[model samples]
Target: MPNNSNENSPPKVSRQILRFLVIGGSSVAIDGICYALITTWSGISPDVAKGISYVCGMLFGFWGNKVWTFESTKRSVSEPIFYVLIYACTLGLNVGINRAVLLLAGDEFRLLGFFLATGTTTVANFVGMKFLAFREQLPADSTTSAPSSEPPEVAIPVSDRRAA
Candidate 1:
């Protein structure tokens, strides 16, 4: 049988990915604006400025991804810890890539370096958060139910039953 409803609807994974991308776009904007502001107004180095902006972006990203992107309700103590660890990796990647670009070619183009670095981490962040960080936790009710102890009643065919 053809599933017309399914044909009209996008796959769940695709929808989640789309939502994630939307959230990421906003995070990037936040990150870029803050990076520009901090670098423009302060004496801080680009690397340091970017670091601060990146963390701010991550904070927004975390909330957006948790509340809207993934639609997760149950909270686990370990998830936040895990999220921090994953962002730690992402932070290193973003900072390292941006600094490397600035050192090599984008010194005059700070935003360019920022974009290049942000591009590098976007997918990793999504995958990590989708699969690990904010994945839904199912309670026992949502999974297999507890087994029942009662035995099933059996009926015998009239032809097979004896006098009884």
Candidate 2:
């Protein structure tokens, strides 16, 4: 059996990355669908619709990443909060990159800007989710409670003991 401690093995990391990409694609689809529906069918402002759709996508991403992609068993109340903060930061990064690219390259390269923003934010979100939001936390007593490196003492009864 594979050792559990060696979680950073190439195969394991590859699997995690693949799962992350799948979840990311699903999240993006959810975001796009929601955005389109809200913008086309409702009176909501486009900006507000975007925000709502982003949140929906963020929620799905968090759930999928936590449960399937990362497979983290450690739980903490701060996980969701950290996830939201990370997504918010990535959202700003995405918008900034897209706008900056458009400004530099002109509106003719709008698709390039979109692709750049999407790619950059995707990478950022993966890093943030892996390292911050769902990282496994060592137990509080792990250090102090570690087993001794010395061999365990073996008992010898008088009948079993022989003179050296």
Candidate 3:
């Protein structure tokens, strides 16, 4: 029974990572679609359209990560502020890397540059969120207990001690 209980423990960190990846992927798709539509239909510059789309995507990513991925229901004023700060920092990094890639790869292969930039940013964001944004929730619960440091002593047979 005890062993069975241990087997049922939830895999916390892996589950959290998987959830974050899934949500982040969805948010990126949303951002890309929004940026494409705005640039194509509204005659907006790609940069402006990307900025607007990023903000929308950031909002989706924040709520998705905060509530679903981290299971963090703490909604104090500071929460949003901290999240926004992180988003802004990541966004700046993303844009810088994207521009650098474009410059290096040349205008002819700008699309490839953008893809590489996005991939890099995705990995960076995942690491940042795991370590910085959600490091508070450590030592997740498990059913199994660790063995005690003290050595166990031999015990007399119960029947021998009682009757003999």
lDDT of each: 0.81, 0.89, 0.74
User: What is the C-alpha local distance difference test score of candidate 1?
Assistant: 0.81
Residue pairs that clash (backbone atoms under 3 angstroms), model 3: none
Candidate 3: tens digits of C-alpha lDDT, residues 1-164:
23343221368667877898899888889899999889889978889999999888888998888888877755567656767677677678878877887788778877886777677777777666655665443233442346558785578898888775
What TM-score would you give candidate 1 relative to the actual structure?
Answer: 0.59
Can you write out model 1's per-residue Cα lDDT over 35-118, one digit (the tens) per residue?
999999999999999999998987898888888888878678866777788878988999998998888885797898898888
TM-score of each: 0.59, 0.73, 0.57
Cα displacement (Å) at residue 146, model 1 = 9.5
Q: Candidate 2 lDDT, tens digit per residue, 47-81? A: 99999998899889889999999998777887898
**Top candidate, metric lDDT:** 2
Overlapping backbone residue pairs in candidate 3 total: 0
On lDDT, the stronger of 1 and 2 is 2
Arranged by TM-score with the best first, the candidates are 2, 1, 3
